[model samples]
Target: MKNIWISCAGIHDTLRFTFHSQLKVMLTVMNRRKLLLAFLACPILAAAPAFSHEGHGVSHVKTSVTLRKRRGRTLHLIVTFLNQGRDAVMLETVAVENAQVLNAVKTAVPAGALVEAPVSLRFHDDVPGIFTLMLDFGEHGKGPVTVTL
Candidate 1:
């Protein structure tokens, strides 16, 4: 066969052009993969925060009736509080149930803490059959739990 003649520089240029085209295609595929991954992860990234605590009206707050004392035309209640989460929780002063004394008392409870004493509450005149404790944990976290009558 007759010897084929080609310049060394011409060969190099053709190889370089092919390499650049392949590189460009690979880069485009990588960019598409990155965009797809980001799109798929959007929901998880915008997800609502998770709370360590779950029970009670709020995750961080837990309430119980330690003592219920009733007097003539008056009822006395002793409630307890506990925080099961790592962050502090704000407790509403007044409950959501009827016959509640709205004191608007707000208390910030530390995480992993418990109330030392029972909270004293009073009810005059008509006594409610059920007591509803409203809890606002913030971040769209709220609970309106009820105890016995």
Candidate 2:
């Protein structure tokens, strides 16, 4: 290219303006990114309490009874008893109550570290709709865990 004589002061002014403009654009982008992050984090922070028990501590004996497998009217479930406490807790009465079960539920859960009870539910009606299953963990007194399916 052909060399053109430009004033030193003019070159300094041009560079200063370019640097300020680029800095302003970069600052605007950073601000937008920060605002977007705050917006996205608000809901998760607000909904944290709903998902977990923040105030309520972990239960000593946590029981979960859910259906493992289902074939027609016969439903199979594995009931899990988790002991979070340091002491060994004996889960006495681990029972399931539903409309399908005709006789007494076979809950032979002996006192141990971790207990799992396998249960089978036989439905009377051909078409099984929404049924409430109440799990009774007597003496352990954790909960009669209610489940709907």
Each prediction's Cα RMSD?
10.3, 11.1
For model 2, the stretches where C-alpha displacement exceeds 4 angstroms are 1-58, 86-112, 126-130
Candidate 1 off by > 4 Å: 1-57, 102-104, 116-125, 137-140
lDDT of each: 0.60, 0.60
Report the error of model 2 at residue 133, Å. 3.4
lDDT of 2 by residue, 1-149 (tens): 22334445788876776677677778898999999999999999999988764223225667777778888878777777676665454444334433455333445343335677776778765534554555544543445566556
TM-score of each: 0.49, 0.41
User: In model 2, which range of ten residues has the least summed lDDT?
Assistant: 90-99
